[model samples]
Target chain A: MTKSRIYLSIALLPLLSVPWFFGPSSSAVVLGFPIWALYSLAITLLFSLLLCWILQRYWSLLAEDESDVE
Target chain B: MSSEALIDGGGLVVMSLYFLSLIGIGLAGRFASREESLSDFYLSGRSMGLTVLFLTLYATQYSGNTLIGFAGRAYREGFLFLMSVTFMMAVIGVYLLYAPKLRRLAERFEFITIGDYVQHRYSNSGLTIVVTILAIVALGNYVLTNLKAIGLIVEAATGGVVSFATGIIALCAIMVLYETLGGLRSVAWTDALQGILLLLGCFAIFAAIEFHYGGLRSLGDQLSAARPDLWLPPSSAQKWGWLSTLLLLGIGIAMYPHAIQRIYAARSTDTLRRSLQIMVFMPLVTTLFMVIIGIVGLSQFPDLDRAGSENITLLILTDLANNIPGIEILILLFICAALAAIMSTVDSALLAISSLFTQDIYRRLRPDSSQQQLTRFGKILSWAIMAAMAYLAIQADATIWRLIVIKLELLCQIAPAIILGVNVRRLNAAAVLSGLLAGTALTLFLMLAGDPIPSKPLGIHAGIWALLLNLAIVFLVDRLRRPAE
Candidate 1:
């Protein structure tokens, strides 16, 4: 895997641990949202953006190869 | 408008037209393809571009379960069910582990079924048979469970005007008709529309819920006051449960037979990659919304039992339509989208089952059979399977979500075969075969004699335990055996 892929995978590790660490707490509200929910949504958004970055940076190399071959 | 009036009148009309359009697309698919080969029938001639590929993957992956079962689970489990979002994203992440390489292999080998890949990679017919049988069993359960959901959706959406038994038969008949007409092409084409509708319906419902209920803040306040436990962190046991679910669904769902077939059906590497990149973000839009709906349901309808909770999404839709002004059309659209999700999933599973039977079993049994003959057999098999499933759907007593989990448990065992087979060349056919059998036996044993969710043995999912044992057996056996010269 490329460095970016590895970094993204590492980034995702923390997202998976969000539930374990954040705990469901109603008192910890960020921007009128439960802490857990807000944390999850933030992680999800970050994961998406990071994934898009990985796709653009590394996966496009494969696409370019396909075009070259064609 | 009253719920009954909406369901029986405009709602029914819109759903009927949607069904008709599916059949029309099926006929169009048949006319569009020049060849009658299995590849053309089962894979749309491997000509699916990025858009169709993306939507079909989206539709097939998120079924009726996402809309109904997830919400029900969320309502029942509270904030803990947010793990659903993580598991769904994990499915996409898991795909990155094997899909790119597997698709390349698929293109190189002209692989039609996952069985073809197993047979090609391992050169073990017995292993191929075992893998194929596992896929069929898992997918058959898939069809059975979704068939039940279809009946429930139609019956519920139409305010029970269409009886459950009749709903199953009528909707299943429509699915089989179109599936036979154009196979994967028709399924994918219809899925594109269904996928769009599903997204639209989700957003519409969320918007309506926000408008009427003052968004998640009010709901959160109510939940905190009424159910403080729901706001607490999961216990240690629950954390283990969360990890187990993540691994089970993440790896398992990506290995779904229909999903693998979609990988094979991609037009190009670029198409598959693009679709997957977009797919990685889908849980954000799809499952996350459904989970929110369920969480909101906690405050809105505080006392629903397990079975009743599964109807939370529908119940909320109905309430909104009845009480809110001018949202009847949105309610109807959401109902149609729910049906679309269920039907899309059923058709994809049906096609996968047919292709697996015809390509893997029947063709192996009669190697002399032509592609045309195999295609015919596949069509006939679809009808037969749907008939059997519809019958079982009516008689079966398990909940939709439980049935889905059972399928995933069995399907996850096949993962080592495909995932390890692609990544590890040294893993022999014997190892994979033994691993598969052992994992399957352990999964069944645990499910039957152990916990209802099959995660009671040490709080981890039984499927994950089975997979661990499977890998252990594979590696141990491989170490003992010498490489072939």
Candidate 2:
């Protein structure tokens, strides 16, 4: 993916990272957490994974130069 | 805050041994030093390997606030404090915006401090001086917050056998001693140890909770039954607040002088990249556990006010000791880790402050100073700053969150300068300076106008509003400058 596209996608991740869609009236619980709290943490875990992927696959291309180090 | 001592003789022995090991590491780093140059003392000669780099970053980023204050915040705010996890990740995510570009420049320029980049990029002495002073103030506040945390941990661990003032003075002396002796090398080495302890500490909290109070499920049920307000979904204003927090912390923390210097101190780009990749997962293990502990505290002790809530972790551990046999060992381990977390952060901040003072502020006045002279001056500055912050910590009573907001508000004003300056080559120094000052003025005005004007007007933090104004001014000034050029 293009750097701009990658960044744009990362920018959108925070929207999901917050549990905005869950309303106050919902009483659902997952395991031992409120459903919204569970959703927030699940999304955060995904956020971590996706960021790791981006770092591994794209950072070398985006960074200035690698010849100086290795 | 508790009068009775919780830890007995064995725990005290473990604590003493931990302090001795840190001093030992400092001596080792002193012997390990290659030269009297500022780079050798401050950046570890830019030779930090992947393990040390990753661990030090983890240790530095998760401070005493993460363990104590954050849990307290969670207890008070409930599920809304889960925003803490998102904000922590945002700090690393924002790094992606600047770290790669900044790392390349740092290697090329041999940058010793964040001010070096500001000076090199802007080529404006006035802007550099202003940026340096802002960074110093922000970092000084960071040290102050962590110093207070150190006193709390020491006093709590000893069960008030050691007074708060004594804890502050003694730990401050030890931190300055090792930092002066070994500098970044010593600090990083100690941080690696502290990082492991911190991770284990989190796991201990999880294990203890599961063993005694059942699982998070039981705690969640209890909280819902007892304090239904906590389990309720966030309000509209809170949703807006979360988004605002994401923006402010995501961008602002990346500007931390100590964290930025870590980018310069990396052995290679690959190492830095790998380390940061791992860092993204940290909130899961560290922050999530703290949030859980806070929730557990809320469910168990429903009547705690704000100040009492901050000591909820200690309360939980003390309760565990009373119920569970042999749990005191794990509790002792957690206390050591807690101390490690607080000290690692303070030492790093002190080192950054000393470097910023000696290189950015002092060097500007006396350009003829030798590297050895500057390095020595940095050591002395660390001592002086520690003493002052120690005094302030003992006397002051502000909450950690308040200090965090103030520091980040000041630091975020400089983001356009550092973040945009790294990416946009055509960005002018005048544009950045104007935006920085305007943003800072608005934030200070709103924050200082405490009683009548709300700090988070309309549910959004004052810092985020200031940042919006800051960015708009930067864009406008850049456009005007383009026409003139």
Q: What lDDT score belongs to each candidate, Candidate 1 first? A: 0.83, 0.88
What TM-score does prediction 2 earn? 0.97
Best DockQ goes to which candidate? 2
Model 1 clashing residue pairs (backbone): none
Q: What does candidate 2's lDDT look like per residue over B1-485, in tens digits?
A: 77777788977887888898899999999999999989999999999999999999999999988999889999999888888898889888788878888998999899999899999999998888889888999998899888888888888778799988999999898888888889999999999999999999999887788779986776766787768887677878888888888888887787889999899999999999999999999998999889889988888998999989998888898788888887878778877888899899999999999999899999988899999999999998899999999999999988788998899999999899988887787889999998988999989988889888998889888888898898999999989988653
lDDT, residue B364, model 1? 87
Candidate 1 per-residue lDDT over residues B1-485, each given as its tens digit:
11343365766777788889989998998788768899999999999999999999999999988888998998898777888887888787677667767888888899999999999989999999999999999998888888888887777766667878999999999999988998899999999999999999888888888889877776767877657777666777887888888889988898998999999999998888889889988887888889888888888898898878988987888788779777778867877888899889999999999999999999988999998998999999999999999999999888777778889999999999988887676779998899999999999988888535444488887889999999999988887785666
CAPRI level of candidate 1: acceptable
Off by over 4 Å in 1: A1-15, A22-27, A60-70, B1-6, B450-455, B483-485
Highest lDDT: which candidate? Answer: 2
